[model samples]
Target chain A: DTAVSQTPKYLVTQMGNDKSIKCEQNLGHDTMYWYKQDSKKFLKIMFSYNNKELIINETVPNRFSPKSPDKAHLNLHINSLELGDSAVYFCASSQDRQSEQFFGPGTRLTVL
Target chain B: AQSVAQPEDQVNVAEGNPLTVKCTYSVSGNPYLFWYVQYPNRGLQFLLKYITGDNLVKGSYGFEAEFNKSQTSFHLKKPSALVSDSALYFCAVRARYNDYKLSFGAGTTVTVRA
Candidate 1:
């Protein structure tokens, strides 16, 4: 069974549209994170949540927001998507602050 | 600021031969080190981690890493390579303290030829 899973492996839409990526973890983790992998293969953290409470918010744009209804789910919603927003988004979960994170298959977002 | 470095852009090895992907880290105080692998069209998979334990740590899929305190390095190594093991590897590091977000390396591509 997949420990962490994300919905819609691939997303395609036009610029100025709104999109959301859903994530779920069955590993009973208290912390969840969102990472963006650019075309150059560099991964950067955008946000992190612990037990449905937002923790880390790097200098992400205001268009990007994350909501965790419960500990097991953290979803990312991006409004007014632009061409620069196109990238692979990954969701990860960890048992706690210092544990190794389990990642879900990435969602490739494409904006035209 | 904590950071990780994967010096090699790519590492090539033949099947049945040993392989190594180098990784170095910089962090204040104690550090939590991690190694992850990623295949094409997939997310990064947890390989192993070093958190206040022995210098050498082992993880899934026949992989292990050595954490050298003096050198500030955590390198992943395997005794034998397989073609199926070819993928992108990333090294990450975090401070031992709380709310220590992980910092990842640029990544190294490993190509194992059969």
Candidate 2:
């Protein structure tokens, strides 16, 4: 069974376009996170939500927003996409604050 | 802030040989360390973690890691590696008091030749 899943395994768009990536976790996790992996394979956390509430927001641009309608779902929306946003976006979830996170098949976003 | 470092960018090994991936971390308070492996075009799979206990932690696929508190390092090791073990490996750290934020290292690419 897929514990975490994300839609649109690949995404390509022009700069200034708006896009959204959907994520869902069936692991009954209480915390969810958004991470970006650059071409160099450097991973960084962008946002995190706990029980559908915002918790961690890193040094991301204001154009990015995360919405959690429920505990099991966390969606990332990027407005006015930039070329620098081209990277693999991964969604992860954990049972609590101090547990190993399960990752979803990442969405490779390409902003042309 | 909690952070992890994977000094090596790539590791090459032959089948049936031993494999090791080095990792070091820094945290303000106690740290929670983890190892994850990712195949091409796939998500990261949890291999193991060091929260507390016996310093040496064994994980999936005959993999193991030794947590050194004094050195602040957690290295992944496999006694006998197969070509199928080739993948991207990542080390992550999270401070005990910090929220759900996990700091990941620049992944190390492992290539096991058969």
Candidate 3:
């Protein structure tokens, strides 16, 4: 079974368009995170949610918003997507704040 | 603030040879170190972690890491590397007091040739 899964493996949209990526985890984890990997392969955490509660909000732009409808799911919505948004976004989940994370197959987002 | 650094951008090794990827970290308090590997078009996979206990931690796929508090380093090693082991490796560090944020290094690409 896939512990962590992400939908829309590839997203190609025009500039200024809006897009959303869905993520779900069956690991029964309490914490979920969204990370962005740039072209240079630098990974950075953008947002983190614990038990559906926002815990860590990094210095990300307001255009990007993360929503957790339930503890098992976390989704990312980007408004006014720009060329800079072209990168792979990863969704990860952990049992708790101090546990090892399981990551899902990343969604490759391309903003043309 | 906690951070990790992977000085080597790439490491090439022959199949059945030993492999090593260097990593160093900086954090205020005790660090929770982790190693993750990523294949092309795939997400990062957890290899091992060091929370507290033995300095030498063994992980999945014949991989292990040594945690050195004095040097603030957690380097990943594999005794016999396979061609399939060629991928990108990341070293992450999280402070004990910090909530749930992991600071990842720039990443090192390992190329294991048969």
The prediction achieving the highest lDDT against the true structure is 3
Query: Runs in model 2 with CA error above 4 Å?
Result: none
Q: State the lDDT at B20 in candidate 1.
A: 99
Candidate 3: lDDT of A9? Answer: 97
Task: Sort every candidate by lDDT, greatest first.
Answer: 3, 2, 1
Q: Measured against the native two-chain assembly using Cα atoms, what DockQ does each of the candidate structures obtain, in the order listed?
A: 0.83, 0.91, 0.93
Error of 2 at A20 (Å): 0.5
Encode model 2's per-residue lDDT on B1-114: one tens digit a residue: 678999999999999999999999999988899999999989999999999988999999999999998999999999999999999999999998996889999989999999
For all predictions in the order shown, the interface RMSD in Å is 0.9, 0.7, 0.6
Q: lDDT per residue, candidate 1, A23-96, as tens digits?
A: 99999999999999999899999999988888899999999999999999999999999999999999999998
The fnat of each candidate, in order, is 0.80, 0.95, 0.95
lDDT per residue (tens digit) for residues A13-111 in model 2: 999999999999999999999999999888899999998888999999999999999999999999999999999999999998768999999999999
What does the i-RMS of model 1 come to?
0.9
Q: Which prediction has more favorable lDDT, 1 or 3?
A: 3
The pairs that clash in candidate 2 are: none
lDDT value, residue A9 of candidate 2 = 94
lDDT of each: 0.94, 0.95, 0.96
